[model samples]
Target: MTGRSDEYPAAPKAARRNRGFEAASRLLRERIRTAGESRGFAVSRLLTHWPEVVGEEIARMSRPVKVGYGRNGFGATLTLLVEGAAAPIVDMSREQIRAKVNACYGYNAISRVVLTQTAATGFEDGQAVFLHSPKPKPAPSPEVQAAARATAEGCADDTLRQALERLAENVLARSAARAAQKKG
Candidate 1:
């Protein structure tokens, strides 16, 4: 038939075009994966060995603050948030923190380190610095648990939350089945 003959030509061209696209896509994916690993390594090295680089600089400061990742036009920035109204809160400005972070990183990648004052109580309460020991225990509550899980999700911090979410779904399904049986 005429239809069969026409389909034959289009089929070969479609197969060839698909194959060409797949090859190009595979190459681009490989390149992106390699570049991601390189950039990830750079960020990890900076964070992992941060104390050695910034420990002295932080020590010199009277005000105690917590350091965490920040963001702006640049990819990942560092932030210094003051924790308390303690006497040692020497009122260092954002610019000072930025300068210190830049010097520590040995790169201008950090656009800035913004300073924010938090109303939370200070290290004077004898809570050890988080870097030095295990994190303090939080009181158990459903709201607290949900918030912790959601925060973990937003941070892209770990796989544990995903595992927990999966487990929670199973538990919920089991409970629903039990309720249905009871109603029946």
Candidate 2:
């Protein structure tokens, strides 16, 4: 009150600096790690990047459920939820699966893989969804594209014409694929 007015003290320079918004992933990383740990996944990459850790073929038929560590914490067993029909196929590739999972951790973290077979519809434990990255659609053939362009040539607007051409190409390609399947 002597010389200065009754204004509140200024915030520290570090706190005053405008640190822009943070990404959702960055903000939730620790929470995600904690949740993954509760599910016995020490390294979250195995769950997040399962398709990349294992080949697409394996990932398509299986999903990592949990990791059960030994009493000594030396050899962990990875449990995979697999479709009933694919269980045998996955069992045959157990060693390969173990190797791939261990490689993902950069260590021999998983000693074995145990398969839990379930119906295609999955179980009631809220693990029913088994999804993977979609396979990329093949490019339409040159012939199909040319035909589509020809069909769309009557359209007046350039953008509309291009969109129509894409639609025609997709329809024609799908028909061609069906025809080929019938022939085979």
Candidate 3:
């Protein structure tokens, strides 16, 4: 047999192109990682908006009923409860949604999404799903403060400082409620 050359075998043109694509993908991934870390975003926080993150995937399978915050903060994992035509379709849809969510988070935050069929309505209207941003933290008000303080001090269990703190929180909540009612 002829002696082999030290040089490697020549890669096909397609293989060379694939390598280039891989390199580009790697660079893009590194940039995203660096940016995410620098933005002070914890991995947990990023996982929150799994739905929005995987929007493209969700669109492919099931229509997004509600794309908003879940239990977490704003733009967190989207609560995507879908009602598709058939069970098999719905199952595949859920998987697609899951993939999209994972892709969106840039990690596997969502293991599986809860899926359900829409209740039959006479007109075939879509399911009633509510999507909303996280409720803003109500600010402390003067009255809440006073009440909290009274509750803390008079209660005997809490210290004076604790009472004041409680009062502050109570007052703030009351004020917020009032403002919300007025808006409504």
Candidate 4:
């Protein structure tokens, strides 16, 4: 045969019709493993399964930066990069997070969890998805605005009156839109 035969002794041409890919996620795992090794990330799928390990809420507020080991074979410390003003929130769930991480590794891999406050840019290289609130809709019509103003005319506190007016306007505009939609 023209081809070298050391590896496979030239598998019959028909025997190698096609070799399609394995799962894409499995393929990506090799890159992930290499990244973990190079970047000192926890090799226990912490970054991949973050949402499952921690609930969605906490996952958005925090992410595991790295697992730092103690000398003399002691337990390791998990540094979590928490975003913005959610430091207290992450601090409150420290033990719970440690327990969950240990369970994931099937061992006491983490002795303590450290919360490090970070900017949103902390996850710049990641594909993490966070829950976002829907944008508030603009008021639909001038009639709703007028009705809201009329209803708020007698209020003593200006701020309270303005808030109440806005609330009324939004509610009235929504109902009016729904009614028009039914007719149309």
Candidate 5:
């Protein structure tokens, strides 16, 4: 038998090297890119960073649907899915939207912006979910907080008491607001 062992060939240096954990986004990037390409999106950044590309107000009312490239592939038309009621508002800001989208690509890639209005519930695919940021609730009045604390005073557990106090505060504050609204 020869001095060299041929039973098991040595593994490649790269394979032997320890590869630590990778980010989920890095692993799924290729899959995301492939899916985006199928929808005529050359770069997935436009879809992923829609909110950042356009302002929060515009993003809340609309979402990017797809990009359509012409036969020559010189200029592409970007289609935005907008809320039915916000169609006119979005249409008015078409130029601004187009400019922002073009700037995102670092070139005037988008020739025009098209808005497609959808019903209140949005499309069949359920892609358009109009999410509005919840307004911060005002702090409960001192009287309301005291009343809430008094209600939770009977609880022995510190954590449970604190939770009950918060619940009472919210309930009392909401009722107070309703009463004030009726008076106004």
Candidate 6:
């Protein structure tokens, strides 16, 4: 037993091979649930689907912040961070937003929307929260470049041909880098 790798039981293997790695969204959900005290989870979902739940016009102007649960443990009030001067329009559309959000949840989840207005252009602020750094992709290795040229040789359009060549190079380089990371 002392010499065995299985001397102590490791965490259980998934029942089916190659099928049990959790999606990144699942981890995000668990974090949201734990941090939100239940109310936050729905709020996060609303934020994620905001563009779909509310129309683009409203979504661009407002963002769901916190959910205040009533004594009934249902019929919650949603607090939204909004752009300045747009609160009136956003407030006016609350009923429509609520309908769309409830439709997203497949039932009634938000009873009212509370707006807190900030800058007139909320786009930059909202984008910062979700965007990763915009670092440019590195140049591909010589092997990848050759492969890309070979792959694009059949393309007829000069512009399309160049675009396909670049895509091939990027894809190959990205895959190679990922493999290297796994190996390391």
Looking at model 2, the pairs that clash are: none
The best-first sequence of candidates by TM-score reads 2, 5, 4, 6, 1, 3
For candidate 5, lDDT tens digit of each residue in 1-184?
A: 5666786687777645366787899999999999999988887998899999999999999998889999998999999888889999999999999999998999999998999888536476766665798898889999999999999999999999999999999999999999999999
TM-score of each: 0.28, 0.59, 0.26, 0.55, 0.58, 0.49
lDDT of 2: 0.90
Which candidate has the highest lDDT of all? 2
Candidate 3 lDDT over 74-167, as tens digits, reads 3433344344554466566666666765565686655546555563332146545456779986656566666666655655545666756765
lDDT of 1 by residue, 1-184 (tens): 5666756655444434544455664667656555534543233433434455455455334332333334434534444445555324434444554565566557665664544445334544645345467787444446445654654575453577677655565555556567779999
Per-residue lDDT of candidate 2, residues 10-112 (tens digit): 6667645366887898899999899999989999999999999999999999999899998998989999989878999999999999999999999998998
lDDT of each: 0.49, 0.90, 0.54, 0.82, 0.90, 0.79
Assess candidate 6 and give its lDDT: 0.79
After superposing candidate 3, which stretches have Cα over 4 Å from the reference?
Answer: 1-61, 65-79, 84-87, 119-184
Residue 148 CA displacement from its true place in model 6, Å: 50
Better of 2 and 3 by lDDT: 2
Tell me the TM-score of model 4: 0.55
Q: Cα RMSD (Å) between model 3 and the true structure?
A: 20.1
Candidate 4 Cα errors over 4 Å, as ranges: 1-17, 122-184
Global lDDT of model 5: 0.90
The deviation in Å at residue 56 for candidate 6 is 1.4
Model 3 error, position 50 (Å) = 11
lDDT digits (tens) for residues 94-139 of candidate 6? 8988888778768887788788777534444654243577888677
Worst 10 residues of 3 by lDDT: 39-48
Ranking by lDDT: 2, 5, 4, 6, 3, 1
Worst-scoring 10-residue span by lDDT in model 1 = 59-68
**Candidate with more favorable, higher lDDT: 4 or 5:** 5
